[model samples]
Target chain A: MQKIILNQTWKGMLMEVKRSSRTKTAVSVVVPFILLAVMIGYVFGPGSELISFGVVIPEISIEKVEFVDSEIIATVRNTGPIAVDIVMADINDRIYPAAIEPDKHLERFESAIVRIPFEWNEGEPYAVGLTIDDGTRFEKQVDVAAPSIQPTVEMITYFAIIGTYVGIIPVMIGLLWFPFISKLSRSKYKFFLALTVGLLLFLGISAAEEAIEISSENLSDVFNGVLLVATVAIVSFLALNFVGEKLKKRAGASKLAGPIAIALMIAIGIGLHNFGEGLAIGAAIVLGEAALGAFLIVGFALHNTTEGFAIAAPMARTKLMIGRLAAMGMIAGVPAIFGAWVGGFVYSPLAAVIFLAIGAGAIFQVIVTIMRWIQNEEGKLSNSSVLAGIAIGMIIMYITSILV
Target chain B: MLTGGQKMIIVITVVSLGFAGYLVFPAMDITAQEQPEVFVTHSGAVVQTTGDVLDPVYTIQEVEFDPEKYLREFDYGEVSQLEDGTTLREFTIIAEDDKIMEIAPGIFYNVWTFNGQVPGPTIRATEGDLVRIHFTNNGDKEHTIHFHGNHPAEMDGIFEIVGSNGGQFTYEFIAGPVGVHPYHCHVMPVEEHIGHGLYGVFIVDPKDARQQADEMVMMLNGFDTDFDGENNLYAANTIPYYYQHHPIQINTNELIRVYVVNMVGLDPINNFHLHGTLYKYYPTGTDMVPSEFTDMTTFSQSERGILEFEYEYTGRYMFHAHLTEFSEKGWSGVFYAKDNSQPNMEGYAYGS
Candidate 1:
């Protein structure tokens, strides 16, 4: 009876093992089909309803309203994250046909001019409303309708005067320090050269930062704006270096020629920087952010005065004619006038970024040249007086920049 | 008592060993690990991947896109006989730019699409057929459809700018050259338009159809999420790693014809590699004869070709971009070739 019972137990265990193996095989096949079915269901089923609500956020800012002849022209900008489409326009609560220049589509930060042919009485209150594609409306009111001021010769003269005050005069005043600097001892002269390096370094860094910020914020992504800035800066640096090397090679024989070349380079670098600053000021004035007040002019003049000193430091030992000094000052200042005209009339973010990048690159190249010169003069880079002068120079620029 | 050179060698050896240890130990530990724990939601539900759920602020809620459905889908358009007795295929494409989609796991991107989908629709036509596209730009930005084929100068999408917000333009052209081409937005800064998903496959068939086979459209693409002029995600379709997770099913010994179009912008070139088999490549499908029999092919932007092959055995086969960086980022997939004798578990009678 015991043998029979053990035989039955062994048979039962074998059967159980076979059954478990079959189940495992079945599971392996079924699991894949189950997952496939789930995936199909998830893909085609109504459970995955992608109905977006409250996602469309439309915003538009009416920057300016002007009356030209019988037409009411309004400049509008897309201020929201998404692009905005202006479909219809209304003036004084009545729908009117309007023409939008450069199409009705205003991409983010893109501005368009809406022209409406309407004869409006002077000094009358009117509400201008714009309707986007989604029927969201944006309205701006004009208390009194008046003819907009077109840019005139008087305006041109005014901008030129501002440029002179901010760019030319301050730099000329700082250039007067050349006579005093030429009398300094040789050791002090080395310190001033180091100081010039510090000033240029600060300027380069600030210009590069501004370029990056503007490109990232205002420029279109299609332009690869930040990359454009970086590329232009790198190219500018290499190109300036190449040119400087050529100049140095040509001026190899004379000790005086080296200082003149360095001084010219410094002026060019400072000129480019001033041009970018002028662009900012001009754009601000055109955008109605800056008033025709003395604060901005005074601040900019004080800030730009240090650039002249940087130029003069390189040419302190060299005897410069008054005509040459005047020409150098003009080279360091005249680009600002052109920059202001461009910025006020046809300001482009791409141009701003490129100009700033070029300025930064030029300044960086100047710094490198100054450092190499200092090493040549003093035999080593880590002099105590040089370090202190550099610190002081940077601090002075920083303080002046705060006012601007 | 050591010389300077000897001391330097010792220091170098010690630093390298430490560096190697830093890299190798964690990798070894990872290899020893089994299945990862399933991420549980706050409400006690098990999530398959961490990216299954995401914040809805930047991301649109549950974008309706199935890469599998798109793989085999084609838009043949409404066919009609013209006055001259030629075939006319009319299609209407609506462009939109206001949708944010989850391109990868938890990575949301603002994709500008044609007909509400990336890579748009695969437009198919005969070589001599007149294709008329009633293109409408409902998006807030300017867009245009430029076809990469022989056409009249006026028919070119450039020069003639289309305004946005209900702007309409009809592109009428005779499909020619008998090849697979790419149609994309030809607006200024074309890279941005293409990169943001404004491209599609255009297949112009020969007068006589080729051998009957399972045909598919594969548009290799990438996305620049950060807009830094470099693509962060790469894929055969819009979603990254989608094909890898859900392998494409195919029948063994069946001819597979794949029309591969590389629409990735920013990157200069992209490539494809098939594992376990070589394919008969027809460069652009312009000629009747096969150009080469190879397992890999490279393509510049907008370059496309025809890849014809058949699987001999039933198993899973891998296919991916030959460039390792692309494959690692998500431009890889698997083809599951099943034997005909197996049970029809897919529920569909048609072969892939």
Candidate 2:
């Protein structure tokens, strides 16, 4: 009687397992499209709705002037958007023929340095004035300055060119490439678990370090205090938990959800980051940094693609409707859009920091989730291949550092 | 530790080296080197009126530059038209200590008075070199006399400056481009003084700008009027007005150069409209040809340019301010083109 009962129990358990494993046809068809639509909206949504009729103009009063190599470099920037269009230049009553453009120097908020390269005769102080020609006419003295020695070429070019690529592309491609191959196939669940772990580790270490560093720099032990640390940790965990649940729900049961989540989150993060990145690129282009921007594009593209795949795979199981799937895909892809917008608009490091934090958080969560899932599936020791891949990733990252 | 003498020697060496390095290989940029220099310049504001006949209350009589030598070498003349079907009249102006010998108190500030104001009585000239006027500003701040006409570079007031608190400068040039341009203070806080009525009209007579019957000088200037058009501040002093539009009126064949200068220290991308006609851009005081030049006209901030176009039909086209916000805050006006051939450049010069 005992043996019969045991057999019956085993049979029931196996039937349940088999029933659960069957992919729901309805879900497969509908969920993907839904997710895709959501992804798309998130990506190409609204940008800078915060500002209406936004027009930035930069005006400058020549603070100091120097003449170098027949070029006039003016250190001019003040409070207000610099919008003064340099009109004309005159020396002792003769029209001085020369070119006027922005100086190839980094400008901080409320301050900027512009270089107006012009043919110089090297004599009396030239009375330089620019006639702003937008809708108004503003004239200011152009303090001439000697041209600055060209910055270290290699260092600048490398960073300007390769920094962007490293920032976006490689990571994306790596993540995406993991699932498509047969032998290299990584289950969506496993990958997300691992990704979540990685992202968490990075964020935890980074945020902690950053907070501690800030405190130390100010000679304060308050941040390192148990209470503060605990608070931050708890807050971070709770936020992460909430976000994680939302992401999971969004992913649904379609194995694709894992990758889709990863992609969508990263893409959004990238979109935010790209805005600032775009500014850098635009500035670079203006300053003759085309090669650098190109290189960056490659890196960003690769990194973003991998990220997309990672986001898409986990949610793959649901087989959501095309619209939802497209939405998810777009959401995953949004980082690029956001990045591009920001890169074109606000050019600041503060922007960079905010994006970095968000990205670090999402990446951490995804990595951890992916890892756990993978470990469960393998039913063996934690995968060494992943470790190896991570190492490789690190090495690649280190190589890019060469450009920086 | 080194002895006191050794330390002193080291310190001295470092200091000397640092100073020397400042001259040779300066550390990026040396701020100390940006000291404001002492130079003669013409900088001040003046208000004036316009008419064919001079208003005895504001007629410019004498003109001189403090640093007389600069004046002797430079060109100085007014943009005016002669009565004999000619354009522009040549005259000399002296800007003395921000006060062109105060016009017996009333309402006057500039060198020559036009209808009793400093902007040297709005002078009406034509496209070609009709009249050349010389000006000298003896004011506290730097100033320039820009002629929105076909003026020569020597006469272009851009290089002229009146010293600070106690300085004088000379401006000389020929009027070529025909357009009604606003002449006012281009300094940092010029809007304050100008809003206090320190500006005038520089009428550059276009070949077709002659209207015998109903002619007027429309000057369109603005200040950040806070409460019911009251107090006005200059650039940096006045708060930014997100929405405000100022407009100027002009008739068909009438040349009007909206001398828009943002001395308000704010970012205003204003759009100039001509109701029905597509405004053709003309030369400002910056770039003017000797005989007749009109091609290479690149607009700049705080610069001047002529918007020329004739209306097909005689109608009061609403030339309202395009900037919606600027318009809402009393920054708007109308272009009542009464006649098809009536050259109307009246009221306050619409100097942006």
Candidate 3:
């Protein structure tokens, strides 16, 4: 009886060991694969629920105007089943919160008005944007004019506004839900890693190209600027990662220490870069270059979409609850909103370079963390599927170029 | 892993396609042409004169060069029809003074002008008026007048085409089939020249309106001579230090017509303001003038108009270029109400 009991115990132990090994293998292979798939979906898949809108006005008028009161008013028409909220309105590089509560339902074609105070001086042009509760947005410009007491009325057609709203739907969806939906039915942590990698790779390559092509009266100076930005971004990213590894080994660091530190650093860098982009946008619209404005908007929107994922990915690593995760997702997108206002109002190319440098540094840091997280258990690193996911993400960017 | 050959092919395809797309999409930016550059006459750009009065550049007012009249007008009860590039009759303008006397030494006037006979003449035609103007550059300096609005490319009257000193060129054009038009000296910066006093008006009537109306024409231009021409000051050998200048003046309700022709070659988009009168049309050529008025109107580019108004009171009313600096310096004039008068004191003047 004693021998049989021992045999049974040994058999049970063997079964338990097998089950544990299987779980470990699954974690290593299947989890990463699923995450990779979600990253790919985010980049290439048709986005969910977000909408876009545009507004065209009499942007250039020599006729002077004297208004009793000047205010920015936006009337939103939600054509989808889901409610679209106005979270904030940005004007002249300043942001003001809108009166949109969470999860507000807006039925099709239902309109709501948002009003804000505005002071427009003659001969100085300005642009205003509305950021919806669902993360979608749109913009319009008030052209510069010489000051006069004469009253003039400018009109914006309803059809044009509606068309713009519809056009932005995909962009909104890509920004708000892609990260969350991508993690569904997979290892959320692994999925975030893949996304971080994708965004970092995209921004890094783009920045490198831009830095190389920097325009300046002195070629060497331009080259120096490019090199300096690259060096700083790369150095900071590596340095932060080294510090994070050291902290992970130390006692008493919080569970969130590594990712939190890395994310905040990256956010700082990206915020700086995005500010310059905002300035460029502002200057273009102010100068009455609508076409250039549109081009910048599209490019920045794409770049911003990737950044939204970058901020969310690190926070997600802590296995935060879903509601908390959604909040973090939005927090990451806040800089973009601020950046847009800045670009639309305070535009200077030199400022653009400085901000871009900061973003490059932050991105470098975040990407290094991502690389370390994905490294093999062995000292040597290898992840074919995640790399494949990157290729797929690039394809998505390619497809959007054609469609957009 | 994928074969090297396959990878090479994939890379080539992706790169080639991207290059193709880059080439294709930028074609959407369609506007890629060079705009004409502005040319100003350099050597004779300024006049050195010392005087108590501020020296000023010359100016032409819209009322004096009304460019917004239609080349042909429809009958009052008839609907206006649209027409383009139809050759019309020929006409001319002569620039002579009113008195026909050598009023003052070295000052000649009262000469028989071409169209109505004043500083220059008014030339009238329809939309596509292939009108030829024969001009005698009998002024102190080599001069040429280019019909500004509504003309064929060959008759653009660019400075390069303006003839050399003592030379002349015949300008031809289809009356601008659409809006008010502009005419000026295609030579050097004509602002100083016109400011020194040299210009006139040309009115192109739409074929549909009455051939002619009870019209009283006036020219609004500015000049700066050392002596006060307003008081007709006389100087023996030297030009007067500071005397009188024309502050372009006009009255309302008299069917007072204007065909402002600017000889100013430099200043673009002079603030053309009309006090107590709102222009009926604002256009490029005298082809599509709006029929009525509401308030102040603006003129842009090389444009002209035929505006009408009536003054409410009698006084030495002032009409000057609205370009504040230009007008204050000397580029303006004044008009007297037949019944309204101001005291012309010994050496004093009224109004800015």
Point to the candidate with the largest DockQ: 2
Q: Which candidate would rank higher by TM-score, 1 or 2?
A: 1
Write down the C-alpha DockQ for each prediction.
0.01, 0.02, 0.01
Q: Give candidate 3's error at residue A117 in angstroms.
A: 20
lDDT of 2 by residue, A178-279 (tens): 334323345434444344344334433544444344334321231233344344344334455456668869768877655555545544443433433444
Angstrom error at residue B207, model 3: 40
Q: Which stretches of candidate 1 lie over 4 Å from their true place?
A: A1-404, B1-36, B39-63, B343-352
The Cα error of candidate 1 at residue B97, in Å, is 1.2
What does the TM-score come to for chain B in model 2? 0.41
CAPRI verdict (incorrect, acceptable, medium, high) for model 1: incorrect
Residue-by-residue lDDT tens digits, candidate 2, B285-331: 33333323332222233344544445566545554335444333223
After TM-score superposition, what is the CA distance of residue B188 in candidate 1 from its true location, in Å?
0.8
Per-residue lDDT of A1-404 in model 1, one digit per residue for the tens?
99999999988886888888788888999999999999878875776654433565667766557677767877777767688667556576444445565556667666667776577887688888766654455677877775554568987787788889888998898889889888999889888888888888888989899998887765445446678778767767876787787788898888877778888888888898889878777766665545543465677788777888888888988886667777788889877777777666556666788889999998888888888878887888899878977888888788877855
* TM-score list, all predictions: 0.41, 0.29, 0.33
Q: Candidate 1's residue-wise lDDT over B165-272, tens digit each? A: 889999999998898999999997888899899999999999999999999999999987656576666889877656665678889899999999999888899999
